[model samples]
Target: MSQLRTILICDDEEELAHELGEFFEGNGWKVDVCVTGMAAIEKLRKGLAPHVLITDLRISDFDGAQVVSVARELPPEMRPLMTIIITGHVMDTARAVDFMCDYLYVKPIDPDVLLANIGEFLAHRTFPAAGRS
Candidate 1:
């Protein structure tokens, strides 16, 4: 099996971050979990270019959407950074799904479901993942 290029998870919830990190790692992805938007940005700036970024909408820290925006502004050679917004609030769901995220999943995200959809999410792209977990 091939390894995942890279995967970033930015969530304020500690347990969720760990669960996500473990999930991606089990699938051979290089995973990094950040609890804050600034930390996420710092990781990216330090060359942690992940193939996928899973973040939440509401947090005590900076907005997750802003984090996505910052990451998206990177050079094209550095982008196509597939994003997934996981929010509990239905109202914020629309914005996340419509623009910021390629896939916006509500709370209680099913780990297996997400894994199964990974390929379809990148079906239209040709970029290989950068690192393995």
Candidate 2:
């Protein structure tokens, strides 16, 4: 059987992370969840290349924007990684406009809307290996 691409979700909310992780896994999307921004960075350093990153704006260790900037510094081959930032703040939404970030999900994350918007962004970045970033 073909393995599903891995997805990394960085959020401090324990319950939401677990629920989303289960949902994604059930849908054939391999997932890894990190409760802190530091852990997320470490996961990446350990070579956990994910197809998508579902993060929160208010992570304990680092902000979503910082995470995005750091991830961009990775080698080209490690690039196609997508990011979706979920926050309860409107300021976070406005700041996200500066980046080529794929998606921004505000608080009260509606599952239906998230999946739909995320799908649209991920589709474009899902290029084959040889295409690299």
Candidate 3:
């Protein structure tokens, strides 16, 4: 098997974070879980660039928007290829667009859908847009 696809999942809820992390890891992806937006940003700044980032909108330290903002501020070569925000709070459609998040999933998310969405991201990365017309 090839090297695992790396992913970072940030959520203050320890159980949820670990659950999502384990699910991704079980599927052969390397997973890193952070309970705070600052921690997530610190990890990214320290050169832990994952292929994707899945973050909850509301956390103890800072909102997911901040995490997305920090991610975007990273040097282009260090940024994650895709970002997905999952939250139980009211959807902030504008923030999603402004932050350049590829997708936003509401809470009580369906694991199957999340998995399928992630698979699409990996495929998209593997096949660049140059392949398109």
Candidate 4:
């Protein structure tokens, strides 16, 4: 059988991260949850390439932009199919322009809406090979 699709969710809030992880898992996707941007970066650098990356803008250790930058620096084949930014703060143009993230969601996101978006992304993307990032 084919492997389940995977997602990486980075957020400083443990509850939110756990909630989102559980939500994704409930739908049959493999999920990795990180409570800090640095931790997420470490995972990515270690070559855990998930199909979708959903990160909070303001996170402990570093901001989401840095995490995205590191992910982009990986080999092209290892980059995530899409990057989703979820932030409670106002989005700055410079950071926004730099990342060119695929989706943006403000704070107080509805889990159902996020799940729908993930489903759409999964349907459209051709995922990369497993075990490389």
For residues 28-74, write the lDDT of model 1, one tens digit per residue: 87788888888988877766778888888776687778778877887
Task: Tell me each candidate's TM-score.
Answer: 0.85, 0.83, 0.86, 0.87
Native-vs-model 1 lDDT? 0.76
- Candidate 3: TM-score? 0.86
Looking at model 4, residue 28 earns an lDDT score of 83
lDDT winner between 3 and 4, please give it. 4
Q: What TM-score does model 1 achieve against the real structure?
A: 0.85
The residue-by-residue lDDT of candidate 3 on 1-133, one tens digit each, is: 3546788999998898999999888888888899998999999888888878889888899988788888888877677788988888775555567556888888888877898888887785652222111
What is the TM-score of candidate 2?
0.83
lDDT scores of the candidates, listed in order:
0.76, 0.73, 0.81, 0.82
lDDT of 3: 0.81
State how far residue 4 of model 4 sits from its true place (Å): 0.9
Ranking by TM-score: 4, 3, 1, 2
